[model samples]
Target: MPEEKQQTPPGSETEMNVKPDHGEQSYVGHGRLQGKATLITGADSGIGRAVALAFAREGADVLISYLNEHEDARETERLVREAGRKAVLVAGDLADPAHCRSLVDQAVQAFGKLDVVVNNAAFQMSHESIEDIPDEEWNRTFAVNISAMFHICKAAVKHMKPGGSIINTSSVNSDKPSPQLLAYATTKGAIANFSAGLAQSLAEKGIRVNSVAPGPIWTPLIPATLPPEKVATFGQETPMKRPGQPAELAPVYVLLASDEASYISGARYAVTGGTPIL
Candidate 1:
């Protein structure tokens, strides 16, 4: 039998047909993020959706800015509301600077204040070598992955008060390079340095900036971006021998966004399933 075709680009959780085990049924919160207003890009699915639901469960109203996955975005909103918190879905391309600015504006307008900004949206196309990567693809990757973060941070900081948190979704690739993801890895590395620089600049304002570098987790992006054979062995190459679940990374977002992490800034948290990043 032939293998089923996978969905591509900004993949949808709803169209996934088989529900991803988001651990929604098992995830519990103790109000670590209560009463906060958070803006999370790419919250329509994957790690973003997990973080959105986790934030909501902890009593934070979330604004999810995604590409164009309406079904996944709606499901995220529904689950957030079920957790007894408000969720707003804003769909647009983050590669545009104007749209990046609007994402911050809309979040603040809806929630009255933006306490946390999670720059989580990103795209990657595998290429065997630098020569194989099209110029357009390289530019698009950087625009969405790095440039949008700059735009959102600049806009979000205007509305954010002291104690604000900025969490960028970096990847383990930032430190460990996979030849196939050269351009994508470059962006992640840039994110790490960007987060560090921003942290220093924002320290005087009491705003903490940091990043979470995930190794591999089961999300729609896996099937959409990787070959089927590669997808089957997704996290097996990792020391853990299995891909992580989204829920596994949600708590890190909670800790970083809350006052509990007030003194933590300019740090990169490695949630890479035992992959050492020294």
Candidate 2:
């Protein structure tokens, strides 16, 4: 099969040539997350949206934070509400430190307590050369990708109780840095380290911190960030020879956010569809 590609800025799944599947009907929860309150950044689409649906179906209310993707965010909220769980949508730029902290406050205000936090929102752009990468872009990437995590976690941890969980979204680029995504890759590496280090720091409080490293998943970010040519063969370099659907990543997130992983902290679980992260 030949690779087909399409592009949309601030990526929209509806506009994507290959619409990303986010476990809409395939996921069935067994009450693993019953009665939990969660705050998920990037919950408007892709992995974040999938996680929100999975969590809600498993008996959790989710606070979804996204950046000006209202239509998509509303859909996510509808799905969560349909599952009989509360869903609150907070739209703003995560690159702003004040917005990051305010979101944590919004979630606590909505749900009264924060049981889970998924720092999954991120930004990236493909550059042919480092010289082409503007300094402002690099700083923006770091601010949104890693710096926002620090602010959100710092604020949310205060409202987190014993047994709370924090999940960060790293990427396959963290281990296998892509020359084209130099800035984004560097931030991913930082995420992996931050998740592990924060895990140990929070261990005494009965809280857990972990990271999920996904390979080329069929999400809007691919088309939105990568060029059309690169997007065509986006995940073909991996042994899987294809991209993973967003739905496939939900189970791992559910496990990490649940009490089932009580002993699983400071670890980076890779769903690379056969790419070795080590």
Candidate 3:
């Protein structure tokens, strides 16, 4: 990767210098999630988009929730539709608790019931020190990253049946903290703990809950949050010496969403290019 200028937080995927591979060409589905009704936050791009596409190809109808990235969201919708599945788009800020609940409501309304929920939307910013992180930024990070997941799940559980699944997008930082991403890292750690506790609580209900902790990945978030210098060498620290692509993480999500992972819950799967979480 080369040095690149930063975009605003929650960057636009279409504007990326090197477009991410969201399994547009490589992924092959096997009816793993056939006929399932799913809701995925941040489905506009990155891992979320990849999951949406994969789910569609696997025979699931998807409701895509985004944060005002219309162009990116539409592209994701097109991919879902292209895979011959239903796609619903909802744009709103996850920081607002009302919006979070509405996401679940809309998904249930659109699909009649929710079989899977992917809490993938997140807000992040890098700073040199704690003092540089503003109060509002810290609060917003937690609101979008972790709080939204809680609200969405609370509303979705009633709509979901015994075979439902919930997958949260955590980060390697949950185990190996990154000083530059203090707020974001903290929220990720909270998400891991939250998923663990929630999984045990929901076990009797038969709703599986898990987290995916990704290492450096080639996404718009890379250029948007990290400094140009750091962006240039992103993911090199991993043994793979390169970042994992959005497409690379979709299969794990597919398994979790599918009935195949019936016995898998309360676990955090790491896709870190050989970088171990512990």
Candidate 4:
């Protein structure tokens, strides 16, 4: 018998030859986000799945926003419900400003209120140099990563009361640029600046905005975005010598979304496997 071909570019967990470990059983929570309603983009797999599981465990009803990957999204929905919380799946291209507005509106409509908005959806392509970067890809990268955040925040804030939280997923590449991933890095830098600026602007309303800049973590993006050789040595360059797990990053999201981080805003938390950002 011949082997089935594997899907690429945000591979589906249900179709993956060996399912990527999403930390559903391993992540532990202490109800830090209890009663909060969180909407997470790219929630079907990888870091988004990890965060979704963690949020559900902490007693939050989650609205999962994903693009395609229906099987993975269904699995995420299953896991969220299994964690004893509600999960609402919102599917579409977040690159659209209208869709971004709808994401916040649908979540608020379904959950009655929106407390945490996690802008985690993104796309990246690796090229050896900036000259090789496609203009369309560069523009799309910024649209999905930074523009979508802007849209979601603008729409969600209308219904988000005081103490609402917005957590954007920046990347280590924001501060430490990866020459090959020029366009992707640029968007991440913008996300960092946007988070800081939005945090300050929303301070008077008591709505906190922050960002998480993760170092190399084992995710589907590794294989989808990088060459196979690069994928094989993905996190080897990090000081930890291994990519950080999604489970490891989940707690940071929980902390930032919880009342425990009441005093925190406009801060960037680097979960980059001992990679010094300074």
Which candidate gets the maximum lDDT versus the true structure? 3
Q: What lDDT tens digits, residue by residue, belong to model 1 across residues 1-278?
A: 12425778656666554455665898898999999999999999889999999999999999999998888899899989999998999999999999999998898889999999999999987877799899999999999999999999999998989999999999899999788888889999999999999999999999999999999887788678777777766788888887788888899999999999989999999999899874
* Candidate 2 weakest ten by summed lDDT: 1-10
What lDDT is reached at residue 143 by model 3? 94
Model 1 clash pairs? Answer: none
lDDT to native, each model:
0.89, 0.91, 0.94, 0.88
Give the true-structure RMSD of model 1.
Answer: 1.7
**Selected candidate, larger lDDT, 3 vs 4:** 3
What's the TM-score of every candidate structure?
A: 0.96, 0.97, 0.99, 0.95
Estimate candidate 2's alpha-carbon lDDT, on a 0 to 1 scale.
Answer: 0.91
- Candidate 1 regions exceeding 4 Å error are 1-4, 17-19
RMSD (CA, Å), each prediction? 1.7, 1.3, 0.8, 2.6
Alpha carbon RMSD to native, model 2: 1.3
Clash count, one per candidate = 0, 0, 0, 0
Candidate closest to the true structure, highest TM-score? 3
Model 4, 1-278: lDDT tens per residue? Answer: 11223347765556534345667668776888889999999999989999999999999999999999888889889989998999999899988999999989889898999999999999889999888988898889988888899999999998988989999999999899999988999899999999999999999999999999999987767767787677666778999887787778889999999989999999999999999774
Tens digits of lDDT, candidate 3, 185-215: 9999999999999999999999999999999
Ranking by lDDT: 3, 2, 1, 4
After superposition, the stretches of candidate 4 with alpha carbons farther than 4 Å from their true spots are 1-7, 15-19
Answer with 1 or 4, whichever has the higher TM-score: 1
Task: Give the residue spans of candidate 3 off by over 4 A.
Answer: none
